[model samples]
Target: ENNEVVYELLADMGWTGDSIDLDSWLPVYCKARYGGCPAAMDSAWQQFRETVYSSLYSYPRFTWQTVVPDTRRISKLDVSDSFLQGVELFLSCADSLESSPLYVNDAIEYASYYLAAKADDCYKRALKEDSLGNRVAAMQQLDRSVEILLDVDKLLASHPLYRLEEWVDMARDWGKTDLEKDAYEANAKRLITTWGGFQEDYAARFWSGLIKDYYIPRMKLYFSEQRADLDRWEENWIKAPWHNTSTSFEDPLQSAIKLVERYKGE
Candidate 1:
């Protein structure tokens, strides 16, 4: 989401002699992206820039990406609410903009961000339940959270740029032999999960393969109350053979539509 917007701004600055593009850049970028920048879309992006992208945030990775209960993971609802408003406004313009490939891509990403925030809400609740010694309730909420993450992966997979397959496949393709292939793939997975020493998930991404095969499974073990050596588990996964299969997917906008409808009321 930020990448496209930043690129748009940078590209515009490159062309303009003065190198100044502010709110005006958004509609022009939107028009170039979706073929037309309607008023609602303009407003949505305005809110997005003001609220979400206006400054740097301490946490780039999601709370669940920590893979453990953490006070730092507790996000303020106000920010999420503001971001959701932008998402809603963006989707409201879908009737006119949905046909654009860029719009479809952004729809999947924007709506996925909404669903991810909702899932993070459940993760926080699960942490609270666990703190209260309500194991059953905690487990239930954790299950729901991971379920949403898996679904988020599905929604993300609709776009080529967001798939974990692209990450791993690109790395593996760099190898000239099976050993090199495995080494490259392991390094690729390791970068996202365990980059050596105490930085598990420091570079975590909300990608399809990572969530389904990596994050969700790790979360399950974390909440299962079992004595799990997470470091060992993570290492095993990194060195293990690649198991994520790339699949055909629906149009991104269609996936976004179904996903947002399923979780919006939650």
Candidate 2:
């Protein structure tokens, strides 16, 4: 595992440590960015710069400079739904991780994007009435989503056992509606079956986490009639029938990957 992580880290940085490249784009770019540093500083600088570059312009129009959430504010906020939703937006945009640690570090960010957007809609309605009760409710949703993000982030970063499957089990144990449990089970199984290899590739990793852990399960809630066989369903939640987008990368996951690659290239 240690060697694998090292190899991946080096490959990501265009390092040959010893292999010959049949086709390489990262080397020249690496030279351009870090050729001036001392040998000892070169690798470190390259890693740092690579992370920053990927974080900003890797997807769509996302630039690393884009502001989302301040982690320091997590404890200070009133725990309102809208505020919590903002935290979700932060996680969705890949703001929680200090640098380009790994795609999973940004897991919460992606989850938050969906959750915060929904919470934001609720807050809009609550704004019309300006009722304390609605305001509190909205905040509660945001807070819950944030809490979930925190857990997912940690799982993605340090623990392989805490996969989406476990999340489904948690939902079931929480004694959610039968409809919810069924939906959760179906999606969790899909993730495990489709992309559970623990592969190091970012695309595979992101898809595994998002599809299995978040997207499909969330859809189950909308179907009041419990689905006995969710595997038979062919709906694409990322590009749901209700979502309208003129761009090919408008799908949230795709957009996020693009952003990551963009930042890496910089």
Candidate 3:
């Protein structure tokens, strides 16, 4: 119902199921949200710029459209009506351990994309309002965008299957006993790291402070700034430190292993 409400809001805001190019919109969004904070804006701008560049080498071209949720498919599966049916199907396939990995992996991908789509929709609305000079409306939409993203994070965290440790355990118990804990952790880390290479291009956001410390404050600055101060804002934002754009880095497998060990201790 909550998701439905959000979708309705997006529809009312003129979302037409079309793809939005994050490469173009992200800079604008970041400027609106973080323009006042030089440090924040620079960090965000660098990440966004790198993400766009990295997508050139990534297969299928990572873009907002690529991750947008298939509302048609989601609509077909009425969760309330099909809950029992889904449980029954799961029970029926309980013995099929071979397919467990496939199912779990697919679920992760689906959830990530769905959340990305929701966030993107909110972003588009925010952009529209900003363009129309509706500062308050734009701020509201931006806040909604971050709220939806944080909610998705919470939802994923609440689901056992979405947790890395749980996923590893499930795979290990399902006839992959040979899968070492370190290897499993490394694989999970790689999945997240790769997806996050393009500035959370695949909904790999893990930080909870993003909204409170960065996004909201930036939007506030944007709303507070006068038209005459826009040039100074841009100048300050551009002067912030620029991080390296290259994302061709190896996964921190050892760190992932340590994380797994700590999770086990907990």
Best by TM-score: 1
Error of 3 at 207 (Å): 8.1
lDDT of 2 by residue, 186-233 (tens): 554444333333321112222224432343253333222443444334
TM-score of 2: 0.22
Model 2 stretches with alpha carbons more than 4 Å out: 1-223, 234-266
Q: How many pairs of residues collide in each model?
A: 0, 18, 1
- Per-residue error for 59 in candidate 3, Å, reads 8.3
Q: After superposing candidate 1 on the true structure, give the runs of residues whose Cα lies further than 4 Å from its correct spot.
A: 14-21, 69-79, 245-251
* Best first by TM-score, ranked: 1, 3, 2
lDDT per residue (tens digit) for residues 1-266 in model 3: 21222253355458556765654544454334323223333343344334322332223311222222333222122122122222222222223321344333323323333444445556667767888999789878767666655544443443334443344344344444444544554454334433344443243333222222323333445555564564454334323322212121032222222222332211
RMSD for each model, in Å, please? Answer: 2.6, 15.9, 21.5
- Model 1 over residues 172-246: C-alpha lDDT tens digits? 999999999999999998887788455446666878877788888777877765637776788899998787753
